[model samples]
Target chain A: MFYREAGEFKTSYVDDNQTFPIRFDRYRYYFVLFAAFLVIPFAVNDYWVNAVFMPFLIYSIAAIGLNILVGYCGQVSLGTGGFMAVGAYACYKLMTAMPEVNIFFHVLMAGGITAMVGMAFGLPSLRIKGFYLAVATLAAQFFLVWLFNKVPWFYNYSASGQISAPERTVFGIAVTGANTSAWASYMFCLVFVFICGILARNLTRGTQGRKWMAIRDMDIAAEIIGVDPLKSKLSAFAVSSFFIGVSGALFFSVYLGAVEVGEAFGITKSFLVLFMVIIGGLGSIFGSFAGAAFLVLLPVLLKNVLVGMLGWPTDLAAHLEFMIVGAMIIIFLIAEPHGLAQLWRVAKEKLRLWPFPH
Target chain B: MSNEEGYVTADGRKIGGTLMEMKNITLRFGGVKAITDISFDIKEGEIRAIIGPNGAGKSSMLNVISGFYVPQEGEVWFKGAKRPQMRPYQVAQQGIARTFQNIALFEGMSVLDNVMTGRLNYMKSNILHQAMWKGKAEKEEVENREAVEKIIDFLEIQSIRKTPVARLPYGLKKRVELARALAAEPMLLLLDEPMAGMNVEEKEDMSRFILDVNDEFGTTIALIEHDMGVVMDLSDRVVVMDYGKKIGDGTPDEVRSNQDVIDAYLGVSHD
Candidate 1:
């Protein structure tokens, strides 16, 4: 009853086709954005920024990227970690080489570089599909990790073979490397995420998004109906990798401040993002954020309860975290293959028809 | 009424010059031949039907026309120009649109979205414009939506516009597929087994819609069907194939009286 569009009418196609057509939804969205921008920066601390907000925000971008490819485009990829590494490494190279430029440009350029790499790996997808494509992307994951580790040039030939973000500022306030405040880093990543989210949301809701879904639902039919598989698939890879790369740039430069390729972006990292997509929902933007938040926050919540409160061993809590994530994945796959997005959809549907049993 | 170039049908609609012509088209999957030395021309604004028993390669011929299969030998001509070796989307860009033998609607997408995809060829806004979704992109989308809405209304699928194709019944799904193909506003519309697996009422509805679409849009149609009754009622001309060979090609009544077509349908003795 409270969530009704009874009196609200859309007078124009533009009004009807908005991202959030309902007044209530639109307001809620604005409120969330307001809170994230105005309120969170003030309230955020180093502990909350590093442990909770940073990971959630960063992974949300990655999940959005992976969701566009696997969820909307129907191309399964397990090379998210590798693409992120490409982003991280690209950002690192850009920062060190072009120290005079803005860090924002470096992040965007890093995303662009990763997008090209993603499209290169995505070529095999035109000839292969399903499990075969998955395997091909797995090869990309291995090759990329190997490239960063063996090539020492990627790390600027550092003696330690690790890439570190140098001190960089946006508007003269440090947003990367040491001496950066928690809010500075948080706001920096937040800006990227917000822009990425809008771009992704708009792309998915428009003509391009329809083409991807058309391909995902039925490739042959999509072709007959005038969707170019090459353009669609490659564009999906380009856009998805762009987001993933930006997140990777932020993950390395803003959040962690230092990174060893193997330790930072391994197979586990790939699986972690994959799990976020699976558990959150495959073909939903909201599910990306939901999955990222759920997975990112779960470990911290578990750690606090099990280790900090109950005095349980750290390793035990870590093991339990793994088991819980695994069990959640299985449950979501079995119970609701569409993930939490479907659940949210059903809830809204019910709310729409409230107070009357059909 | 008889015209200089082509004759008028019983309903007084003048059929125009050749829109698409297939000359000596031969298709094969490795050693297995699908269509052998088949030649046909679909006149503008006429309903051309291909009918044969199982394994007659009618579907393969449709595939060739739609550019899904590249004939090992032969030329496909559209609008008096020899079509190049191109992809399906290229063929679609050339105003050739088709529906599958099986319902090929995007099962996960709403009927509106599925139909909207038909306008992908007409969408000219670049990726950057689409990402921002303002100005040209928004205007183009609204324009496409208007076109799709008209088709939905034309097909009487307005009630199910927002419904996913997977949730629809067989008949409705078939209609949605037709709506999608029509949304392309194709010059040459190909329908493979449009009435397959439908009840008599559903078949009648499909036939009526097909005729209405042809009459209203003046769309040149080429279809494959197993039902002779629907074929005879709906198509102006019919092409009969048997074992990858064209057995007969004529008007419905001419094909009905052809000895070879009767022999092929009745399983006549080879000796």
Candidate 2:
């Protein structure tokens, strides 16, 4: 009943070109949003929202961002962690320098600054491509994290080599740092994720999205077909950076409260995000969300179910989680390169017919 | 504005309005020369073919015209003005479009979306409009679909509109690529070896589509073809290249008669 489209007629051509053809899909999206905003907070306790769900939402946003550049645009980048660091650092700087500025604006500005940095790294993509270009982005990750750590100004001349969020609020609700409540933080991040998800969807669905995909599909043919690789590739970097930067800002300010430069947004973090996108689906917008959610929730759920409940050692549980994730990536690549998004689609298809799947 | 923009030439031969002109292009890749002082003109509303053996830089020529590879020497003039050193998108903005030799249809995309991407230049709405799926973006999508549908009809690819490009046959994929190119409504159309890998029936179908595109749209076509018969039949004039140099230029019959072209095709042995 949750996915039934009995009578929805598409009268106009505009209606026919929708991302979702069925009316059930539209309502389902609305229902999910409703549950996320309303039902989710009440259903789970504060610890669950803060420790698990909030971080997952935030990671999804960053995964979606990296996916735009790496997946959709066909640009290989290992600097997502660096860009995320830029976001977090930028937010810190903005909040300190302009105390009166809205936390929302500061978060957005962080993303904007990250976009500029992402573009700078993306310049090398024009000269180099494939694995060679990927190596160039790895340089971005190393150099940026190193620079941020050394630069005292980025950390506000903190005595310790770590930056922590200050008191930040939105509409009288604590939304950042240690003082923030679990529900408020989750809601804030969830809202940001919602807006950014919609933004990513729009961007990838339009001329910009088509341009990136065309380049990803085939650069030479893309050129003949009138796609400017320079503009498209850079735009991918900019938009992707914006999402990641914002996510990083949230990861520190809302979720983590405090983060050391090398610790939080390191190369491992970059790989984690990349893995999320890869396992979700390459060259798919929805795949970014599916991947982020699957990867984020799986380990936590696994550790809890396998270790916490079954009384296994934490090390063994962690190892099992890693192996499962690794094996799934390989299987997905060989069996269904589209990842969990494809799985979700298949599930939806079966749901459409219910008893009669033939 | 293009180099030939608003210019008129009342010549004895047919002045179909110079849509695109590659002026004395000299392209070199380090030690090897790709195109050596080659010059060609495409008249508006004419089907001009570039014929050459392998390694004659036929693809290189198309690349230069499409702004993929910049020529070392010479200017590309379009519609009566000196064209800027434009990107591929800029070239498209100047009302030029192209198809690839290997059927460059976006493999994972549906035939409809692949063709729709050709109208990317014309889709005016911004990200905000697209996000809301609101007024301008919706209207633009509708307009784009209408235009693409016309191209689909022209290519007779009605059934495979929703089918992914990867699943389509080689002939259908090539036609879809053409459909995608034609969707742009380009003033200058470039097709690189459109019938190179096609069977006899597929070649005939592609030829018919090409003729219809030129006739119906008044599009100026500059094609590189291997099949001599298709080149002779479809094109008004042929520019033959040998060793990156223009060996013969004129009507197909004239190029066919030229002894240099004959020698280039059938290697001339020194006495």
Candidate 3:
């Protein structure tokens, strides 16, 4: 009953075009944001922060990036892992080269660098599309990982192939490195997540989003009606890679603390993020979060339930988790191809009409 | 209707001079010629129709006008400027908008969003501004929304503003396509078989919208249609094509009286 928009009227176009036009949705979103920023960090400890929240937030960023390309702009890409590696490597290079610069700027710049890389890779998209484009990006994935692994300069000519994050602080509070507190790192990633979420939502609802969607839904019609395919596709790539890069930077410096490129951002990483986008719902920012949350929590939940509570072997539980994820992907594809975001929308839609069926 | 003073409709709306001219536009696909030496000029503030039997290259002519298929040899003149070889989008940027023969609505978006897409060329804020969604981008978005809302209102699709284009009926989809083209606020609007699958009432509504668009906005319109009644009633002038050649081009009555036009329409044995 509380979800209804019965008497709540929008007075202007500005009001109508809000990300959450309904008063209830707007307030609920504010409450979620409040909990995420003000409440969650206080209650959560290291285990929850490191194991659950960080991966969810970081993967949500990557998924949002992928969704913009594959979902919004209809460009299927398999190079997410490679692009993320670019971000990670770029961040690594910048962190070592300029020890004095803020980590925030480094992360943003890493994203910028990845955007250029993404645009360059996106050049082939203008000529090839669909499966061919996916295969092209798959090449990007393999090539990027291989490049990072083979290039010693990327690792600062270290004896080992691993590149580790040095101690970094913001306002005297350590957000990265071995000495960092759980809450500081959590808050840092949380801030990026919040900002990125807002930026993505804003971009998708405006002109850029329209152009991308127009290109996605019907490229010929879009081009004929004045959307430049090159701009839209490349912009999608640039924007998507920017987010992916940011996530990758955070993935390395803040989340992982050290990375061997092949082990960390492998092909599976690409598929994992793709799974999040597919299971979450393509083309939806909220879906990115939903997919990330579901996938992130699944393994944890399975470990506790299947291994801890049920006394199953660890290997068996891991195998079962894989099976469950595979089954979930299949079920989601067959049943609700739009993913959890669409389910949430339908649920909310029904809630709006609760207690009375038309 | 035409004189030394320039053409005027019976309703006394003055049709202006040539807005777009096609000079010897010959489009070929491989060894086959689609359009051969077809020349036509569309006057400003008038509805021009291209009509022919199946395989007469009518759609091909529309494609040439919209820049989907660049002619092998010809020049397109727009408002007295000789248009160079350009992509379809560049042509759209040059104040031309069109609907496809098969309703090409962006099926994934709401009616409002699909129509808003037509406002893309006018939306100038960069991605940075768009991401922030405050100040410049917000102001531009709101202003363009105002313009789009007007087109939505004009087309009377206010009720289904937020409905996805895929969910709408075929008739409404055609109207949505028109609304999208209109959202561009082009100097010239092209409609490809707008009433192809419409019922009697829907066709009348579309015809009225076409007339009102011309009367109110003074938009130059070029259309391809199979419905002879629609062609004769809605168009100020008609171009009849047969076998990739312009058989007749004149006022509807003049074309109706042409003997060659009769043979093309009624079919005559050539073999």
TM-score of each: 0.97, 0.90, 0.98
Worst 10 residues of 2 chain A by lDDT: A1-10
Runs in model 1 deviating more than 4 A are B1-4, B269-271
In what order do the candidates fall by DockQ, top score first?
Answer: 3, 1, 2
Evaluated on chain B only, candidate 3 has a TM-score of 0.97
Error of 3 at A239 (Å): 0.5
Q: Is candidate 1 or candidate 3 better by DockQ?
A: 3
Cα lDDT of model 1 by residue, A1-358, tens digit: 7468999998888998998887888899999999999999999899999999999999999999999999999999999999999999999999999999999999999999999999999999999999999999999999999999999899999999999999999999999979999999899989998999999998998899999998999999999888899999999999999999999999999998899999999988999999899889988999999999989998899889899999989988889988986787787789988888999888888887887848
**Stretches of candidate 3 exceeding 4 Å from the true structure:** B1-5, B269-271
How many steric overlaps are in each model, in order? 0, 10, 0
For each candidate, the alpha-carbon lDDT, in order, equals: 0.92, 0.86, 0.93
What TM-score does candidate 2 get on C-alpha atoms?
Answer: 0.90
Highest TM-score model number: 3
Question: Which residue pairs show backbone clashes in model 2?
Answer: B2-B80, B2-B81, B3-B80, B3-B81, B3-B82, B4-B79, B4-B80, B4-B81, B5-B79, B5-B80
DockQ of each: 0.88, 0.54, 0.91
lDDT of 1 by residue, B1-271 (tens): 2233777887788899888888999999999999999998889999999999999999999988888899999999999899999999888998989998888889888888888998998899999998988899999999999998899999999898878788999999999999989999999999999999999999998999999999999999999998888899889988999999999998899999999999999978969
